[model samples]
Target: MSEQEMFLLPPERPTISHLRMFLSDLAMQYHSLATAALNGDYHTSHTPFFTANGNIVGSTRLRALIHKFNTEFSDYMRGKGEKLKLVHSRFADPLIRSPESIFSLKKKKKASQAKHAGWNGYAIP
Candidate 1:
C-alpha cells in the first residue's frame, strides 16, 4: 500500500502500553524534525512535512493529532497548573540561517590569498 494510505489506516485495538509507545515514538520523530528545521536542514522546495507540490503530507493524521492534543492533553495538563501550547502554522524559511557555507567561503578566500602571497619560503623584501 502507498505511504499515504498506510498513514490513514487506523490502528487496530491497542492496549494502553501500545498507545503510549506509539505516542512516544511520534513525539521523538516530531522533535527530531523540528530540530532539523531549526538548524536550517530543510529548504523551501524540500521538507518532509510538505510534498514537492506544496501539499502537506499526512495532513489528516496531523490534524487529528493536533485536535486531540489541544482538547484532551492540554486540558489535562492545565488542571495541574501546567501550561502547554501547540501552534499550528507553516514557516516560509528556516528558524535560523546556516553559516557553514559562509565560513567555508571565507576559508577558501584566505587560502587563495596565502597561496598567491610572498615568495618560496621568503617575503619580497
Candidate 2:
C-alpha cells in the first residue's frame, strides 16, 4: 500500500511479525549485555550482542547502544554513590592502588626509562 511496500517484490516484503521479532531479539540481547556488564563480565557479554543473523550489526547503531548504556551505567553509579561499595569492596581488589605503590603505574618511571622512551615522553616518535 505504501510507496516503499509497492516497490518491494512480494517475497521481499517484510511483515510486521518480522520487525517485531527483530526488536524482541534486540531487547533480549540488550538485557543480556546490561546484566553481564553489571556483573563485570563485559568482555564476554558483548560478543553475542554485537552480531545478529550471523553478521555484525552496523557500527553507527552499535556505537549508539554502547554510548547509551555506558551513560546510563555512569549515571547509576553516580546515584548509587557508596552503595556499590557494599557489593564490590567486600573482597580485596587488584585495582586497589596508589602512586608510589608497586602495582600502581601512576608514577611512570618505568615508561620514562630510556630503554622505552621516545618523543615527547610518549612511546610514539
Candidate 3:
C-alpha cells in the first residue's frame, strides 16, 4: 500500500460488512502502531475506519461487534509495537471493589475541594 493511501468507506453508503472488512484490513495492514501511525500519517492520511459518516452509528449488534474488533485490533497493534511500549491497565476492577483501596480518598479529596470552592459540582482537575 502507498504510504499516503487510506481506506475510505463510500461517501454515500457503507454496509456493516464493509466496516468489518475495513477494520480488519486496517489491522492487518498496520499491525504496528508506528506503522498504523505512519500509514495514518499522524491523522493526516488515515483515520480509524469505524464510523458512520465518521460519526458512530449502526444497529446495536453491529456497533458492539465493531467496538470489540476495534479494541482487539488496537491491542494487537500495541503488542506488535513494543518499541512504543504501551501499557494497558485494568485499574478499576480490583480497586473499586476493595474498601481498603486508597482511590476513595482521592475521590473524597476532589469532592471536598470542589465543595470548598464556590462550586457545587465536581469536575476533573
Best lDDT among the predictions, by candidate number: 1
Question: Tens digit of lDDT per residue, candidate 2, span 1-125?
Answer: 88897777444428899878878988998787767655545346375554554455534244556778999999998887563232235575555543235435544566557546555655565
TM-score of each: 0.31, 0.28, 0.18
* All models, RMSD in angstroms: 22.0, 17.7, 19.9
The TM-score that candidate 2 achieves is 0.28
lDDT by residue (tens digit), candidate 3, 20-97 = 887897787656544644343333333444234554532323446667799999999877755433233685444444
Query: Which candidate number would show the highest TM-score if scored against the true structure?
Result: 1
Across 74-123, the per-residue lDDT of candidate 1 in tens digits comes to 78866865343333447623432345655677899999888777656565
- In Å, residue 105's CA in model 1 sits off its true spot by 50
**Candidate 3, lDDT over the whole model:** 0.55
lDDT (Cα, 0-100) at 59 in candidate 2: 40
- The best-first sequence of candidates by TM-score reads 1, 2, 3
- Global lDDT of model 1: 0.62
- Candidate 1 residue 73 Cα shift, in angstroms, is 37
Q: Clashing residue pairs, candidate 2?
A: none
